[model samples]
Target: MKTTGTVPRLTARGVATRARIVEAAADLVFERGVAETGLDAVLAASGTSKSQLYHYFADKDDLVLAVIERQTERVLAEQEPQLHELDSIAGLHRWRDALVGLQRHGGCVGGCPIGSLVAELAGSDRPRELLRAGFARWESFLVAGLTTMRDRDELRPDADPRDLATAVMTALQGGLLLTATTRSTRPLELGLDMAIAHVEAHRLSRSVQPRGRREGPVDAGPARPAGTSTASRSG
Candidate 1:
């Protein structure tokens, strides 16, 4: 969970170099795909010589794993604050709209980078393991946000935050896959709406009491604060 900028000075430059290589590799892989991308291409894109490249990444596979980790951090960084603010229906709606907007704006060219890695590495143990770890970390972040909602009574008392987080993660990955294959955003939009509906349906509601004139009971759900969607806001 350490920020990339706070690494100790002893190997700061080396860490920065490695990060640059990973970033370059991720961008290339996303643009050209794994099958077409090569180590030489990554080296050229990163502006790192062969020795430096080898020093940072032992091989193409190692670089690919590093790219996966880099993408994981990038995705989480983009999502954190907004996802953490999902304690109200309005906030959740913003989150969903942001996701839809991202795909629409990107021309649906880029789905989830982690999901792309998983597809490229299907049946490969090493890559699969790396992907599993990345997804586990991502799911943990979502679960933390859901737990916050539960604590604020925004979610039903008996709701399983972990399960809800996992379901959301599953739907996102599946939706991304469908979007990539069909070159359409409909599936992603529909899947996200269903996910939001599920979350809203299980949202906690409180009994409200009327004031001076008359006494009546009212249903009060979570209150919304000024919030923005991370996905829609991302570049």
Candidate 2:
């Protein structure tokens, strides 16, 4: 969030006020949207005037960047200890359940805060790098965990951590996108299920003294296979 430029150092009160504006703006944008939510709305919500809003953010784009950072933190925070220990299958399942619970709790309102913004502002160059960085950070965490799994012989020696990690994200984002489109968590559940299955499939056999599903994260029943579900349409 720190920009490279000459700027006035804000007093402690000023810092709090600026955070207040950003928090209010974040809430507004998440509920309404970046295009629809205006600076005046942020001003009203934050209980600050135009000058105060501008004092913190150079413009709406600056505010958007801050919101992006806020959302990145929020999303990563939701993953909890599982995110930190994604090297194991149990951690992956925990992460998946956490996401499912999150979608169910929020009623699957916004797909992803940062993701929604990118869909709206993808054409803009200013925030693209920041957005890229945000996604990359999340991916990096997965990559690190998967790498550990590979190194510890939990994953097959031939497995590629980078590709597998990215694929998991692909499934996750696809689910999120579908969730946003249909207003249901089914897609999210299916996507993560497949992604976790794919990851678990690479486990090294115990013949090699490797950690298997029994020693790590284990899900009940065989994976529900992508696209296989019990729900049906009634005529």
Q: Would you list the clashing residue pairs of candidate 2?
A: 90-217
**Model 2 per-residue lDDT tens digits across residues 1-235:** 4742344998999989988988898899888889999898889998999998877777778888888888788778877567898877777777787787777678778887777777787788877777778788888888998898888877888989989988988888888878877888888888888888888778875525444445434333344543332231111
Candidate 2 at residue 201, lDDT? 78
Can you give the lDDT of residue 107 in candidate 2? 76
- Model 1 scores a C-alpha lDDT of 0.70
> What are the per-residue Cα lDDT tens digits for candidate 1 across 128-194?
8878988998778667767876777767889898899788878888888787777676667667666
lDDT of 2: 0.78
Over 4 Å off, model 2: 207-235
Alpha-carbon RMSD of each model: 6.8, 3.8
For model 1, name the residue pairs that clash: none
**Each model's TM-score, in the order given?**
0.77, 0.87
